[model samples]
Target: MSPLIALRAFDDSINSNSSVDGVSVVKIIEYVVIGIVVLSLLALGYMGWRHRYNLKLLGEAIAHRKEKHALAHGRRTKDVQ
Candidate 1:
């Protein structure tokens, strides 16, 4: 027999023996689990972005405060001399 005919026969044998109901249920559950994992990762990425932005804002505020303090201290010393 040809290769195509041999493959068709093998497929027919497999289909005849396998049950469809249990396989469909298992496939549905597997897809749901995969979707949950993908959604969890997306949530984690959003939280990380928010945390980084907050840290950047805090650092800028601290730097500005330090500069203002230094300028005021310098003027006080100049007046005394």
Candidate 2:
């Protein structure tokens, strides 16, 4: 659902007053499952982003090390004499 629709639904849920005040077992379980699913998705996304960043950093580090090693060995050019 779009953000607007979700926001409207949330607003409605919050504004409406139910006839019964007590919470149902089914509702509790549903809420728990929804929360868990949302959290799991968030965690998965974060991990994926972190992994990408780490890979990029590793690539950069490797490239830097290669450049430094080349300077140290005085073999910067790839062309053979």
Candidate 3:
């Protein structure tokens, strides 16, 4: 909403007898909080997925390096201890 509209709503709420605008304000805050929570959960899930993918790559790299080292030392691939 525009700043002018928001200011008008606030002004109307203050002048009104009932708590009608207050209910809208509370609903807006509730929606904002729910949105934040959902976004944070998605971000954390993505981070976790990335971390696992990186770990798998690191493991493969380490295995490749060890195999290369063993081959350089004249050891068979399966015989390397």
Candidate 4:
């Protein structure tokens, strides 16, 4: 079936009083599922961004510590340079 027909059928089913308090249970469930999907995508994006930022900070810290340790040893290695 076409999307329009499916939507029309859903609307008809809702209007035909297959609901509680004028709200279709299936429609509410669909909305809840959509909400969960959107929230999950947002959370995944946030975690990915945070992970990238933490990795950048960690690399910087490691480079700085490596340089400091090399300097204290009075030898500038090729890696530190």
Best by TM-score: 4
Order of candidates by lDDT, top first?
Answer: 4, 3, 2, 1
Candidate 3 per-residue C-alpha lDDT over 51-71 given as tens digits, one digit per residue, 9 for 90 to 100? 999999999999999888988
Which stretch of 10 consecutive residues in model 4 shows the poorest summed lDDT?
2-11
Runs of candidate 2 exceeding 4 Å displacement: 1-21, 77-81
lDDT of each model, Cα atoms only?
A: 0.67, 0.73, 0.75, 0.79
Which has the higher lDDT value, candidate number 1 or candidate number 4?
4
Question: Residues 10-71, candidate 4, lDDT per residue (tens digit)?
Answer: 77765566777887766776678779989999999999999999999999999889888988
As for lDDT, the candidate ahead, 3 or 4, is 4
TM-score of 4: 0.71
**What CA root-mean-square deviation does each model show from the true structure?**
10.3, 8.1, 6.6, 4.3
Scored against the true structure, residue 74 in model 2 reaches a CA lDDT of 88
TM-scores, all models, native as reference: 0.53, 0.67, 0.67, 0.71
What local lDDT score does residue 38 receive in model 2, on the 0 to 100 scale?
A: 100
Q: Candidate 1 lDDT, tens digit per residue, 1-81?
A: 964455556555665535366554334445676688899999999999999999999998887787778777873312334
